[model samples]
Target: MSNGVSTSTDKIIVDRSRSHRNKAVSKAVRQTRERLQTGHVGNFDRELIAMHISAMLQGASIMPVFVVIIAGLGIYFTRDIQIFTWAFLTLSAHAINMLLAKRAAKQEITSESARKWRRILILGQVLIGCCWAFFAIQGCATCEGQSFAAYKGAMLLAAVCVTAMSNFMLPRAVLFSFAPTVLALCFRVALTREPLDLGLMAIFVTAVVFFTFITDRLFQSNLKILSFQSEKDDLIVELEVAKSMSDEARRRAEEANLAKSRFLASMSHELRTPLNAILGFSEVMSAEVMGPLNNPTYKEYTGDIHRSGQHLLNLINEILDLSRIEAGKYDLSEEAISLLDIAEDCIGMVQLRARAKNISISQQFEPKLPSLWADEKSLRQVVLNLLSNAVKFTPQGGEICVKVGWTAGGGQYVSIKDNGPGIPEEEIPVVLSAFGQGSIAIKSAEQGTGLGLPIVQAILAKHDGQFILKSKLREGTEAIAILPAMRVLQSLPAVEDALTVGRKRKSFA
Candidate 1:
């Protein structure tokens, strides 16, 4: 997690999490839209959207102008028909939206207030469409002439249609606002007796669609592109995050290596001090400088000192191998050794330790387990680590078993099992990681390095094989290792070729 403060800025980053970035961006986009709508921010896209809306309004004014023309005709005919009141009502309603558009332009009103007036205009248009339809139908039934009702009904429909087109962007409060207006206009247009002006109607509709829908969509798209460009700020924020993560990882690595170096240095000094005293005393005893002791206690004391020295030396060596493995400095050797032989040797080394506890140690080998190609030293270390751990955890009179077998069809596998208080199920995986010792082993064992199983895993993995650890509380532990098998003399020709090349290069030199 990154802290919000940069140590230089007084205003902290609101939220640094990536998951919250989308919401943050949406909020920012909304605020920007409102600000632009309210004449606060005049950024390019906002200006462009405003320009597009203005252009649409200008384009739509042509419809109202047409309505005004039709209303003028209606006024002329009604004045002669002696029905001036209804005609005035009809004409006023049809021309109201046109007047509203012009007044709205002069005031520079926002869409909300403009939409309110547009709705009111739509309501009036609906009434006019009904009136024209009623009068046109009534007059046509009798001897009433075309002067009062001729194209008047159709013109009313055209006015209502234009009103619906303009009211589509209204921001709520009106439901089905356009439907009644559109239906009334449609009925009035249906009742007309005049020839259909399809071309003029289509031209009118195409103009409205172009202004309200098509051009508005284009403006929105341009703004979306502008919004995308604004993401550069986000990318810069992410780059800073990635750089910080890289720095933290590097810092952790340096700290870990430094701590390892210090541990190795301290262990080296501690181990050498004990070793020096053991060797000095042993040499003195062997040289008869301590006077030949008839008593067995002197020999026993010397043996204890030797054992202590050996124990310290083993611990030191384990520390060194683990350090080397962690540093990835150990290279695999291309030696092909009998798998059974290595297995037997590892088992033999641990037999004495198990025997001292009266623990029955066993060995089993499947038929035709082939020789494995590996670094003999590292493989031996791998096997040795497993066996030592097995023996240490085995209780008195319990059993320690080693088995060598074929794995799949091409590899050799070995399993080391012990009847000790086994590892817990949850801790089995962690046990193979560095400094990961199980609670069971930690509870029972007199000593352990914790890195032993990790070293084994690292060693086996280098040979393109791996170890499997299975355990249960109070049962037993089993460790399995599988390695790729290489037939004898497979690398002999490569070795010979290398030798020849080296000799020839030397001769040329």
Candidate 2:
């Protein structure tokens, strides 16, 4: 029954439509975005439209020039000319209607008074158009079937057509608005053997009345489209604001990460120096070049000393690696590398550890696998760490397969799939973060520092490669490394050679 549909999804559909419109608007919104940057806000006010209309009309040109001049010339020649009376009378009525319409648009006019004014103005314009039409016809009728009749008839016809045609400006005003003029023109043309000038005027009057009707409807339609465009422009502004906020949030996150890295570095420096000294001194005592300790208790004490030192060293190394990764200072070397060589090396290094658990370490490679462009040592370390983790977690009799292959998009991959107690779903995300280990893993492993996966992540990031882990609870976990196959040559300082520790010691000398 209504022009609009009603349902709960209707609002959602409208919102989606608005979003669609916003995308189209964004391409043209640079100037609007700049304005909003300086903190401009827009509001829908009735006076805004009224003000625009007033501004447009302030410089509007109308046909009054000819009307005034011709009427004035006639009045002057006749010596008792009251050209002002006719112009003032006709123009005043038209002006009053325009003023009423403007104030009505602003709701500044009372309903009762507006209705009364509209009737009066409509009646007045019709009367004036009709009067001119009749007046023109009369000028033709009084003319003898001679020279004066023809000339005067022609002038009257033109005048009547102009007046009747102009009233159709409002389009909808055509119905009753042209009634009087129509009657007057038909009477002069068909009812009498008039010079047919007024008859010609009637045809033009009808056409114009209809013309204004069409234009007024079209103008309103265009205004609706303009309103929709204006709203779309507003939504585009909101999207730009959202984008700016996201950028600001990302910058703040970077700043926080930097601060965290700095704090870790300071902590490492303050704590690890004394730790290294303690380990070094303990190591000297345990070696016992003075001869082996005979007491069984003394040997156990030496073993305890060695074990504690190793644990402390592991902790120190984890902390340092974490800091370096955050600071983007991890030493990495990029070279053209044989994928097969790297995979075989990692498998060999970790074979003993896996064999200790009775787990077989096997390797597979796609035939003619492409060479990788990456840091070979870093890649080896990453593979070794992940494989070691898999072996440690895997039960006895489980197999660890190391597969290397070429990917479709010029990528080389090394995947380590293990028959191990896979990571818990909730723990996988945290494991990739610093110092994150699963509850079950932390309890069972006993010696894990929870930094291995993060280190692997950091290494892969340096190579512009991907490190991904897929695991299902109680199922095997797959850790895959994908590196670009193509080599990009650039002259860079060798990563290990660039380490400045020795240089720092020399500077002290």
Question: Considering every candidate listed, which one attains the maximal TM-score?
Answer: 2
lDDT value for model 1: 0.61
Off by over 4 Å in 2: 1-48, 51-59, 65-254, 285-323, 366-373, 423-430, 433-443, 446-450, 488-509
All candidates: TM-score: 0.55, 0.59
Tens-place lDDT per residue, model 2, 425-460, is 888888877788876577784548889998887887
Residue-level lDDT tens digits of model 1 in 388-419: 88878888888876776655534667778888
What lDDT does each candidate get? 0.61, 0.63
The stretch of ten residues in a row with the least summed lDDT in candidate 2 is: 10-19
For candidate 1, the 10 contiguous residues with the lowest summed lDDT are 1-10
Best lDDT among the predictions, by candidate number? 2
Per-candidate RMSD, Å: 15.3, 15.3
